[model samples]
Target: MIRTATPADVPAVHALIRELAAYEKAPQEARATEEQLREALFGERPAVFAHVAVDDVSGETVGFALWFLNFSTWRGVHGIYLEDLYVSPGARGGGHGRALLTGLAWICVERGYERLEWSVLDWNEPAIGFYEALGARPQDGWTGYRLTDGALAALGGSGH
Candidate 1:
């Protein structure tokens, strides 16, 4: 079952995040702490939201979807920007991932949002196939970019 993550679910979700990072071959980049996640997800005026998927038999939180709002200039509507979605390896064939995504899609449709989007690593062919099976297509012409670490600081004119 998929449901909104409560504060009690933070640690489990945090672990799931580590698993995701490892799978993505970037374990070193999973630096956010549990306290940071708690504050981000449950703080006053929260800027992020999360949902967890529970195992039917074990009742364990086996998956999670963390997201935030993004505004589309062309559509003039706020859409969900999924930051991460992960399901435990043992739970892969149980549809947890699809259920998590379906929940987000429901939110978009219910709120009249024009888009539900997230980026997938180019080398993760299994994930690409899964998303395609769900009727999700790549935004072919657009390239994703980010400025972080020294580049981000330098651009902001702040020496780190």
Candidate 2:
């Protein structure tokens, strides 16, 4: 039961984000507010698109995957950058994760996207295995970088 998420799903989405952060041992960093999520996701220019997996009988969201389109200059085709994917602890290993991945793959194929990409923490070996089993491989030569609030401010002040 996977479907696109709507504005009405913000609360549940926010809760899932918090849960994922907690699972990654960074609960305090899960500070996304409902208003922020709503505006970013459903605004005139959406920041990302979300797909949620719901339990058939319970009608509760069990997992979700958020993604945005990115261009691969080298490949000369669009790609899907998977920002996040989380399945509730109780619902894991119940095919939800695989279903979500399958749904994302379908989106890629249907839209003619050349690639689908995501990152998993080095400590999460199980996730690595899961992704590998799904035929996803790590881009060996790449490293991820980020700029947070203070760093972003400093960079802005530097004025290049």
Candidate 3:
């Protein structure tokens, strides 16, 4: 069963994040703390949301989808930008990933949003196949870029 995550789920979600980072071969990059996640997901004016997939028999959280809203200037609607989607290795192939995505898609359709989007690593063939099987097409012409660490600070602190 998939349900909205609560404050109590922060630890599980944080662990899942580290697990995902390891799967992505960059455990060191999953630097977020539970406190940060708690604030982001349960703060007074929260900007992010999370949903978890629970095991029916064990009542354990097996997967999670963390997302946030993004405004599309062209579409003029707010769409969901999924930040992370992960299912525990032991719990995969049990439909948890699909359920999590379906839940997010339901939200978009219910709210009249034009898109539900997320990025997957180019080399993750398994994930790529899964997404393709779900009718998700890659935005081929676009290359995603990030400005972070020293560069982000330098630009942000610049007066220009």
lDDT of 3 at 71: 91
lDDT by residue for model 2 (39-76), tens: 88999999799999899889999889988999999989
True-vs-predicted CA distance for residue 4, candidate 3, Å: 0.3
Model 3 sits at a Cα RMSD from the real structure of 0.7
Quantify all predictions' global Cα lDDT against the true fold: 0.96, 0.91, 0.97
The deviation in Å at residue 145 for candidate 3 is 0.5
For each candidate, what TM-score against the reference? 0.97, 0.96, 0.98
Query: Per-residue lDDT tens digits of candidate 3, residues 1-160?
Result: 9999999999999999999999999998889999999999999899999999999999999999999999999999999999999999899899999999999999999999989999999999999999999999999899999998999999999987
Candidate 1: residue pairs that collide? none
lDDT, model 1:
0.96
What tens-digit string does per-residue lDDT give for candidate 1 at 44-66? 97899999999999999999999
Q: Given candidate 2, what's the lDDT at residue 108?
A: 86
Error of 1 at 24 (Å): 0.4
